[model samples]
Target: MATRARPSACSHTDRVFLYADSLIHSGGVPKLCPGHGAMPPPEGQNMINESALLESQSLRNSVLERTDVLDRVKALSLLPDGMHVTTAMVATYFGVGLEAIKSLVKDHRTELEANGYQLLAGEELRSFKNLSGLQSHTRSLAIFSRRAVLNVAMLLRDSEVARQVRMYLLDMEYLARTQPVDNPVHRETVSLDDRIDQRITHILGKTVVPMFNALIETSGEHRKELIALRAGVQRIERRLHQHHTRLQRLEGVRDDRPTVGVMAAMDAMNGRRFEHHIAKLLHRDGCTDVVVQGGRGDRGVDIIGLTAAGQRLVVQCKRFAPYLNITSPEVQKFVGAAKVLHNADVALYVATCPFTPEALSIAAETGITVVHRGLLEEWSAGEPLEVLE
Candidate 1:
């Protein structure tokens, strides 16, 4: 007795089709086809392919992962009604490009507005408090313009953001004043130079100096505070001298030319007077090795002195009109020359004005200390320079 054959795995419909097709080709009546049955094509095959299904799943997971990002951006958009967000703050929070964040907010302007988020204009942002208010304002702006947001984020995340910002602000202020003059004649005018210098000085005094002062005061030790304070003062004096040098250069006065001879002579006399005063002040404060204009050679090194601890210091002085800003290269060149000529332990860059951040960074990197106008003023006011042993 033969056992009944086990039903084929293929569906009846599939088997019937196969049998019919074979008969049609052979011109004979259709018969059941052997081994025609197989598992039905994978379920859901008709609606979506396997690859498509996998892709869909992946997309769902991505959406889930990005939920937090979207939520953060949304929450930041609803900061206190009166409070403003900065592009930097928003980019920082979302870990996105500042410009991208800014563009997102800009593209969704209506949506953000509906949700009580307002873009803080550049001017308005500047008016906000420096610490938190400015940060919030930057964030708010970043969410409005992707470009702004990304750029701001990049700047905020940068290690040298403060220096870059300070430089940018200076450049902008410089441009604002200089752009109005088109003619060579108008550009070379003394009034223009004076105005630019005044504005730069104002910015240094009002903005940068205060920040630096706060940093100096925050130092825990007397020696640290004194060093920081002296460095800050030197920075300011360098900047003022730089401005004056730039003004002279802009007026086409060659360094060796006699055209500015009288002016140069006047500056030299004023510098001597200033150095004399500084020397007297330092001497009165129990500093014994205070030497003024002691170095030989035409190099910029102005004074050579020794601290009470026998550490030698070489100083460079600039007595230009106020608001001149000095560059780092000048300071570096001076320091290099001084090191060679005096073999000093430290180089002190003394000026009647301030130095740019680039100058400050260069000094910091090269182990050269700076003494600006503010430090001179402070020292003259009988603030003792705490000795570090």
Candidate 2:
């Protein structure tokens, strides 16, 4: 007897073709200057944002380009494929609760399935897990194509960032439909210097960063130096990214943009300053009488406060480089401090970087809120931490 074939990373190009056919039949997409075409309005937009889906920026699957466009709404991190994103990643991008994303998925499952939403399990799931190095123990995982994510943005009503994304899509669509201005400047041409900068940035992000990761893992004698060098390259990339953002700015960086928010301020601070920053963030969210320990005789907790609803809150701050991972031991120590020593109702282990898979597992098992780099960016940008609510 013949067995069924396992699923692989199937292309969404068929959906794109079908959507294009629908638009053609309904006169939905606006025809543009020769080769150009207008994107549909936010309400009935089909498929995904083509601006983001363009594979021109892929450095042989090493670096994903068009990040500036995606980050306009929020910084959206992608997996190695650069085409797929997890449900949690979608939640992070929208600055909403994970449950909220699940709610959207539940309500729009049919439409999303038509646009490349997938629930992976069994042999296919195991294959993807090995390739991506994902750490979840769940029997299945939910993943979205870029088209499905854009579909979510259309239906999502809770986030200001999502609202901005919808508006941006609408505006771009209308702009493409309008007549071209003879006096208007176009960005189609790449300047020599700008092209050079793009090359350097691409190399640093795709080639050099991974090289440093490998070196740091194997080079025990100079791991710190390797990390430091990696940090310096990351800083350069960030500065270049800022420059690119200025070039990409439409009506200037919007007030809701996170790049101008707490992340920048916190990045400039030292350990003591980070403690105060966390305290102030708590105070901003209506925590009363928040106290910062300033690294003196503080066993593990760096900040303590009471929530607006009169619940005890304890936080431990770790301001590490984004490339570095917070280990399980550090989170374990915080758990002991927050629960055993302080008897806190809310325990937050906040860090500037990501946590190891083991660290995240510990946080989940112990009910600690792990505010890694992505969530910290959201929290710093005035998006209330879901745990706080």
Candidate 3:
């Protein structure tokens, strides 16, 4: 018999034949070739159906889009020197949890590396972790992270994504640096009473005095401005008196403790002969038994006084700057000292500045009253201290 030529299996033409064969076998009705004589389905047909092919292409496109987005984020996170972005900066930007972001970065390591993006170094990441731990909030972490990501994106990518990321990160950085860090400490170690006093002083120095002075300078009519200024001063005086009364009540229990160095500084600042002027004034106003620089064997109590009704009061005086606020731990210390030293009925915190909102809340909850600088002045001047409450 004559040898018929067999088709080469490795040829493209043969593969197409196999594809048509498979398609016909898989419930696809075999049809005659349109131009050529009857032929087999193409090899590509065996490997993929039209519907599946489209779906696969769509999936691949989606993956690419996601990868691009991640890449842009990473590029913005880099610096001009090509250092990997800091995790803290990135976490702060994204408004997400730091741990959560770290985990995401770890989980997506392969993806990031494949795209030519490097993960943040261990040391850099550690700093972020420490900051996040110290700060104790997800909002800060997210903001930090987002910023880092934007820097990386700027360095790695030249696309519009990079531009947008840079702009957003810059705005965020501005806000973070300009605005106050919210409750930087999870637990406060400073006195609440001191914080309240400090806040009062801050308001008087920064807000009250400056405002009145400006009004006085700008006012055309001397009498009107003077009257307004006098009224404002009186308001402040009343507040100070109330703060002093509260301080007297709180400090009545620690009568024999040595005074702290800050007390002298405060006395000088206030132009008083002694730091105990507030206590003395209160004593002269029938809140007697008030002692200055008193309180023995007490860790935090500064002044001690006793009401006529025999209620012992423990006081802690704080002279702090306006920027440095007091913490809850400080309040706790004074309260603990009062319980141990005098078994006082009330705990009072008097500060030259303001108490942080957190400290104020804690004082209220713990029944530790706070007296600010304004109130202290009112009490010292023998004015009604009722306005503060």
Clashes of 1: 55
> Could you give the C-alpha RMSD of every candidate to the true structure, in order shown?
30.2, 16.3, 32.5
Q: What is the TM-score of candidate 3?
A: 0.30
Error of 2 at 270 (Å): 1.8
User: Against the hidden true structure, what lDDT does model 1 obtain?
Assistant: 0.46
What's the candidate order when arranged by decreasing lDDT? 2, 1, 3
TM-score: which candidate is best?
2
Judging by lDDT against the true structure, name the best candidate: 2
In model 1, what lDDT does residue 286 have?
Answer: 55
Tens digit per residue, CA lDDT, model 3, 1-389: 23335566543323333443443345343333344331222222222222331234332222231221333223234321122344654544343455755675565444444433444335654554443233333333222222234323433322333333333333222221222223333113224444444345434434444444444434434535344554565356445633543343333213342222122224234322334755765566555577766445545577777764567866787765422457878877776777776687866787765566778888888778777654554454456443122
Candidates in descending TM-score order: 2, 1, 3
lDDT against the true structure, each candidate: 0.46, 0.65, 0.45
State the displacement of the C-alpha of residue 362, model 3, in Å, after optimal TM-score superposition.
Answer: 1.1
lDDT of residue 354 for candidate 2:
75
For every model shown, the clashing-pair count is 55, 0, 84
Query: For candidate 1, lDDT tens digit of each residue in 1-389?
Result: 23334456844333433443343335332232344221122222222222332234332222121111222112334222112345556655554566865565565455445433455556655543332222342333532322222223223333232222223232222322332233455444545336445445544444444444444334334424444444464366456745554444345333343221322222334557766756665567555677676446546666666766778766777775433667888987986777777787867676756688999998888777777655644554556555312
Ranking 2 against 3 by lDDT, winner: 2
Q: Which scores higher on lDDT, 1 or 2?
A: 2
